[model samples]
Target: MALTGPNGPVMTREEVDRTLTRLGAERDAVEASLLALQDHPGRRLLEGAELSGRTRERWSEAEPGLGLLWSMFDTYSEALAAARAVRSRRARPGQSELYEMTELLRGRGVTVSAGQLPQGGLHITGSTRMSEQVSLTELVERMNTWYGRIIEVASAADAVWTALPARIDLLSAELGRVRALARSVGVHPGEHPAGDALEEMAKELAALRGEVVADPLAFWVPRPGAGTGAPGGSGSAPGTVDTGRYDRAARTVDGLRVQLEDLLRLRDDADERLEGIGETLARADATLAEARRARGEVLAKIASTEVPAVPGPASAMRERLAQADQLRRHGQWHRLGPLLDTLEGAAQRELQRARESLTSVTAPLAIRAELRGRLDAYKAMAARLGVSEDPELIERYDQARRMLWSAPCDLRAAEYAVMRYQQTLRPTAGPGRNSV
Candidate 1:
């Protein structure tokens, strides 16, 4: 018999030496990898940390694979050692020794007890066996499989731990500072929207940190070709941590911080704003007073003309301005901000309304003054035309003058009389006169 097995044919002396060299190197490399996995920071953290969710479930299954790796490494070492011993028996082995070496290296000559096989490790699934015989090549493949599985879980957990927890801690500190600033400004929860949001964000960050610590794998996002990309093995690629929730919370906090800064600016400028409002109210009151006086004059001088009523000062706006000042004094900047905006708008409207009233109340007096000026100008033109002594011209001019000069002047009657006087100043058409 040639003593052929799974890998086929007994090896020559040179072939056995070459095989021993390759297997020896492979054994050393696998041992180094196994020790590295044992001491990996991620694995150590996972072992001690209180885990939950996907990380918990995965660790529960993958943890046993650690023991299975060591057991399988021992089996591999023993097989390699047996092959070396067979070759060492002679400077060059004969057929019997060569056949034995081939069986140890390539045949199904390694025995693994059922107890050494963790359920999640080798995944052997035939009828129960007290021990199972597998080739040294198959045993190496099994160790590589379990090694890849355990590393994916450990590395992912470690990546999340490295990325999120410290950042969340820094955000929490910033939140604390903002809360203190809000209290100083009287911006408490239920009193201001920004304050309420800050409170909510504090809770959100705390919960986010808790979840990250307990189940970091939940926040990991594997790259598209993760499993096939890991070096020296088939496992996950080093994917990024999911920072979506943390980023949103950070933005919200930044917004609230801006709002508080605005309130601080408002506090510093409250005096200037209040003073400007007072000046505007003063102008509106002065205009209204002038309108009232004009109304009186129009009633006394103009006849049968309706005058517009002038309203009083902007007392409501002034009162609100006072209230706004009070709020500023008490550091209630949120309330003061809106009140100042309303008062500014109202003050402008009040000033405009007052000016309009003055214009309306004095309109009739202005008309009477215009008519008087027109009547006098026509009388002067008649004198220049040498018609000042004409009986009809004199009568019309005096009548229009009386109506215009008198108190409570009838503006309509004065206008008619002025027109009649102007007609009298024109020459009658006659021979050799040419309508002079």
Candidate 2:
């Protein structure tokens, strides 16, 4: 495949075969390059080593592989082209040329697709001042054009490929270390793939690795795991440990791997469904960010909100209940009735406020707004319907009821006032003189 000028004599089949044999040798050389790359251990490069000491040398060696592959590819392609040209020329030379190229490629386990080559651009650019004949000159031009991209891709791939074997060994060693530590700690050391298994694991580990690789900040989030401070201040309930849950979680990780493979195959194209490897990672990052922000906001709100809890002296409610029981046993109907009235009022208002809070937290902007509006309307109705002091009186009534029902009892006057006030308002006042 290495282009040299036709020097000594005209081309013959024997000479061409010799040249092709050399091409086959180069193919072999390139194929052998894989093991070399593996031997070099490019872990540092993968770890972000760009052109460091050993990398540059490995990179330089890796660079030559590109040209080698390119040459093999070109030669195979040319053999194909020659066949095509001979075929076009009444199946004379082209057919025979095609036969020769096909034999060589097939022998080397290579499948050359000259017909697959793009049209128009073809030529050899490598300076071999040793040639004057243009036997494959036009074909080389096309080869060079195609070779550019091939070389570039191979160069990059080789850099990683070259170091892969060593990296795998490195990972294997590390995993062994980890296993030893786990054994020392009396924990199970799980099996993991060799580092070189990335390509094999690529499909299966796509989603998981994508998250770890692309967005470390997001994936390593502090999850609300055992002992982790989470919402509702929920932490791990301290107790003697059960390993069952840990085992289940480990199994879940396996499920995650399955999910990753499914994603790689089924969602390779989609971005929105978050089915692809890259998108899954991006979505996780975004989801974690939002979740964290929400948690903080809720904590802040609870810390600062002015919502009151129940009504009065918390112990007072117990005392009042006891007093009511005594009054009832002694046939003190008057006191019992008044106490009951106070408890009802305080309980009603407290219930209403609590309900409001629940609604506001859940349906903040709308449900709470509607409830407030209803209360406002009721107040307006109270005043507009000739009960000028009814709104304030109703508020006091509610507070009294709340105090009596909660662990408190201090609204004696408010309860008595409600009773008297209740008698004054007719049933018709509410839609038709309804009682207060």
The residue-level lDDT of candidate 1 at 237 comes to: 37
lDDT against the true structure, each candidate: 0.83, 0.39
Runs off by more than 4 Å, candidate 1 = 1-6, 12-18, 88-93, 115-128, 223-225, 228-238, 365-436
Candidate that would win on TM-score: 1
TM-scores vs. true structure, each candidate: 0.80, 0.18
TM-score of 2: 0.18
How far does residue 154 in candidate 2 sit from its true spot (Å)? 3.9
**Per-prediction count of colliding residue pairs?**
0, 33
In model 2, what lDDT does residue 367 have?
27
lDDT of 2 by residue, 222-318 (tens): 2234332211121122223122322343354445344334323322322222222223333334444444444444444333333322222234544
Residue 427 lDDT in candidate 2: 44
